[model samples]
Target: MDLAALGDCLGTSSCLIFQTVGGLKIGLLMFLVASGLTLIFGVLGVINFAHGSFYMLGAYLAWQTMALTDNFYLAVLAAALGVGLFGVLFERGFMSRVYRGDVLVQILLCYAFILILDDLVIIVWGEEFLSSLGIPDAFHRPPLFVGGAIVPVFHLFIIGFSTLVAVALWLFMTRTKWGKITRAAEQNPLMVSALGINTSLLFAGIFALGSLLAGLGGALAASERSISSGMGFSVVLESFIVTVIGGMGSIGGAFVAALLIGMTRSFGAIGFPLFTDGLMFVLMCLVLVLRPQGLMGRSGG
Candidate 1:
């Protein structure tokens, strides 16, 4: 065994720290995207294939808005709100009619939406890699050194923002009456509906909220990365992996899985460069063999 190769694989203390921070940043973004997918599945019992398209839509909208207004905050806000509202419309116009249909119908509807949304993006954005220069200069500032490891300020910002959102979501779910009702509906939709709660409105709200989270993820990413068509599809694939590993309809599971995946991706490149791409798939297979319901998922989930 070559010592130099071993050392490179293990990485230095500073390199490890840098990778850890990078993992955290990626995990935060994954959580944001997966949260909505899990929420939608948990509440509506629908596996949304088009959730990622909404994320892509958010990034495009953010770029367009920022180009017009030259305001990063405003652009992000607008993108999230716009995509969320579109979700509401989509649920009302198409999804409501098929809520009671078979799973195939739901899948087809969402898949169709994905195609439609993709074409729309091409029409609007013209299929090029949009530059991220529209984002404010503040986001491109210098990095911070922790124990001699370099950490980008923007990545830290993402981690902090995601943490804050997670906390707020927890408080909302545990403390607010509406949030409590939503949770109850997730567990027992029939009971809630039979008790006079408007299930349609509840479902719409859940879908819209989930879409909003996805959009927020896209908006946050738009400033730092090059945007293009099919971006949503790529994110949705990873989001599906996170949701699967976390367990369908399990928010806490999604959070934990996101971090696990983030760290895996960050370190796998160093430790097992040749197998990094298949690492998650291998992990997913193992998890399935041991616990088909996922790490934090309930039985049959």
Candidate 2:
């Protein structure tokens, strides 16, 4: 394309709107994964290196569930709940001993799990791209239109679902007793434990909840993208980047950073395609230089 064509593409109203919507979708997907990772880090004080593997497992499980039941909803539910249970077992059987252990030990334990889970996924799913077939026909059709630009209903649904999840999380964290205890434990676990709160149980629950969110993200993507081995590794890096940019352990920060990275990629593709991948890191670096603690993160933790 010539400069004139590129200029015209950049100036089109429909093009801009479509890109904005696309960016939001990407951001929402990242938020689903990053939110969980951040929550685990903030509350449990352990960096879950295997979180992405859980995401990959979720997608594979979703594929199998959809194949069996031929129902998209059931597949999603299975993926989330199954992965959550796996997380609980992991916390109880392995992570429990390493809780508050040396950072190196925690990292090694999680890293080992990542390798094990990767092999498990390959053994179960094989080395092929698993296609999503159980999606509703309506999801494939675009019902929304704007200025000659068509927008798929499924994309809109994803955005709506992500919003609902965010709201629900906020309510659970603020209104529920368990949520309150979880948050309080993050600040002072010893005190909470002294007060008769089962801190161990609370940590396990938080870990499971985080795993569930990651699984939900993976299941959501499985409907639109092909599932493959090592898929989680790529997203895990981005999720961590989002966590870092938003402020370690700040849910709201993760959300905002996800959007920022998404928009940067979308717009960068139009304006500076060559730098698209690096742009996110550049933004992250700038944020770090300006605010070491992150945009919303507290100074410590």
Candidate 3:
């Protein structure tokens, strides 16, 4: 395209509005995955390298569930609850022994799991890439005109659903007794353990909850992204980037960072398409240089 055409594209009101909404949808998807990874790190003090694999598993499970049941809601629930139960088993059976263990060992263990999941996916889904899922009947309605821009309803649904998850997560973490105890244990496990509470079971539950969130994110993306072996690896890097930019262990930080990256990618594509991928790295580098602790993270964390 000529410079004149590019100028017209950039200046259009509809173009800007559509890109804005698209960016928000992208960011929220990242938030859903990052929030889970951050929570596990914040409370468990363990970096869950296998979290992405859980997401990959969720995507496949969602595909299989929808294939067998043909129920969108059931597919979503099965993907989430299935991985959550898997999380509980993983935490109790494997992760429990590695608590406060060597960082290298933890990394290696999680890395091994990643490899294992990749192989399992290949065996089940085969080497060929699964086709992109069709938008369900509910989400297949005509695009709505917003500010003179046509916006897909599915995009709007992702934004609204992610917001609801965030709010519900906040309420669960603040208003409930279980939530209070979980927070307390993160800060003072020994104290909580001394109070006659079984911290082990609590940790397992938290881990499962985090896994559930990751699975849900993947399930939601099944229709938007192609399913393939090791699909989680693609978003895993972005999720970690979001976590780092948002401040490690801060869900709100993850949300904001995801949006920042999303917006950067969207608009950056218009001006610097060649450098779009690197823009997020530039943003992350700036954050590290200016605020090492992250936007919302406390110092020394």
* Alpha carbon lDDT at 224, candidate 2: 83
- lDDT string, candidate 2, 1-301, tens digits: 1445446656998877777788888999999999999999989888898899888888998999998988898899999999999999999999989986899999899889988888888888787778864456658664678765667778888888987898888888889999899888878889999999888889899999999999999999888888988889998999999999999888889989999998888777777778888989999999899998888899954
lDDT of 1 by residue, 265-285 (tens): 888767777776688888888
Top candidate (lDDT) = 3
Return the clash pairs for model 1, or none: none
With candidate 3 superimposed using the best TM-score fit, by how many Å does residue 26's alpha carbon deviate from the native? 0.5
CA shift of 68, model 2, Å: 0.3
Candidate 3 Cα deviation (angstroms), residue 258 = 1.1
Q: Measured by TM-score, how close is model 3 to the native structure? A: 0.95
The lDDT of each candidate is: 0.87, 0.87, 0.88
Which parts of model 2 have CA positions greater than 4 angstroms off? 1-12
Instruction: Show the lowest summed lDDT stretch of 10 residues, model 2.
Output: 1-10
Candidates in descending lDDT order: 3, 2, 1
Report residue 226 deviation for candidate 1 (angstroms). Answer: 1.3
Colliding residue pairs in candidate 2: none
